[model samples]
Target: MKAKNGSMVAYDGEMAFKKLSGGGEGIRGMVTRRITGEQMTVMEVKGHGTCWFADRASEINLVGLQGDKLYVESSNFLAADAGLRTGTSFTGARGASQGNGLFTTTVEGHGQVAIMSDGPAVVLRVSAQYPLTVDPGAYVAHQGNLRQSFQSGVTFRTLLGEGGGEAFQIRFEGDGLVYVQPSERNTIAGDV
Candidate 1:
């Protein structure tokens, strides 16, 4: 299993933690991760029987994937089953380098992934019948087949802080589940 460093709380059997590159791609990956502003600090848990993990006091959410890819921010990522594969991909203009990661960590294959959020995450379903739009700040992760498009509501009024408009929104079209947290602050989303 691969988990965020310092997330291990307890274990019942023999386990050893080995630090790994952001996506286990080694030193070059670290350089790329730094240049692209990805936060994927993690450790590998080997020979484990039972293990407990946590992101301090943050809430933990489990997502089950069956031969599907999960798009998630490294900040919210907690852990993943060893059978899963991890990688990074560029998410274009979701946040635009405003402190939110423009690249997200992806987990692929059949397994369960652990994610951390500010509070109990809310799950929203998006399908052909009904598409969903989300504020980037509250966005956490999305699973299944979905199309995301960047939409901007910024206007002259936005600069004056007097317009009834949102600066930006990510529209999800297709079938999928989106995980979001309750927040008043603006955040960013990864690529679909």
Candidate 2:
């Protein structure tokens, strides 16, 4: 119920647990409930959770996943959970609509899991005013309640360093918190 000295204390149905890893590093939370028969769960965190993030523009970080329906950029990516069926697909690459890497394990609702990144993380509350445009590579973890999609149709001007739109972007539009790493150039499982 309470965590001090950079630790996480979690309670699940009269069962309490603490996170051995300290906070201020990345997404820190606990599993609250498990979905009936899926490879996903509901996670809850104290304070705002974040991923390895940096504004440097060229830094990279390794990362890993622990849930289904994960959205990640092709570049700056290293590896994923061991249980995941590895595959690569571009923004509009053929068969991308299949949604392969998104979900890995089979968990149900109310279940909890952990997502890890290289360093510290930044939690953002997405909304219309400050709509979050996450670089696919920088995405780490998000709530199961959020919606994920792909956005395309960009003009040449946008690709000429215009900043409005470029090649393509994996879009997450909904009312849920997202974890992003500052280092958007690192692969999750690439050689460090």
Best by lDDT: 1
Candidate 1, superposed: residue stretches over 4 Å from native: 26-31, 185-192
95-187, model 2: which lDDT tens digit per residue?
132222333222122222234444656777775455565555556655434556665545665556564533445576766666677654333
lDDT, candidate 2, at 90: 28
Q: lDDT tens digits, residues 1-192, model 1?
A: 889998999998888999886667677777778888886788999985899998778889999999999998888999999889887778877645224657887899999999988989999999999999887778888988998888877678766866555567888999999998886344332221
Model 1 worst lDDT run, 10 consecutive residues: 183-192
lDDT on C-alpha atoms for all candidate structures? 0.82, 0.38
Model 2 earns a TM-score of 0.38
Give lDDT for model 1. Answer: 0.82
Instruction: Compute the lDDT of residue 45 as modeled in candidate 1.
Output: 90
Prediction-by-prediction clash tally: 2, 43
* TM-score on alpha carbons, each prediction: 0.89, 0.38
lDDT of model 1 at position 137? 78
- Error (Å) of candidate 1 at residue 143 is 1.3
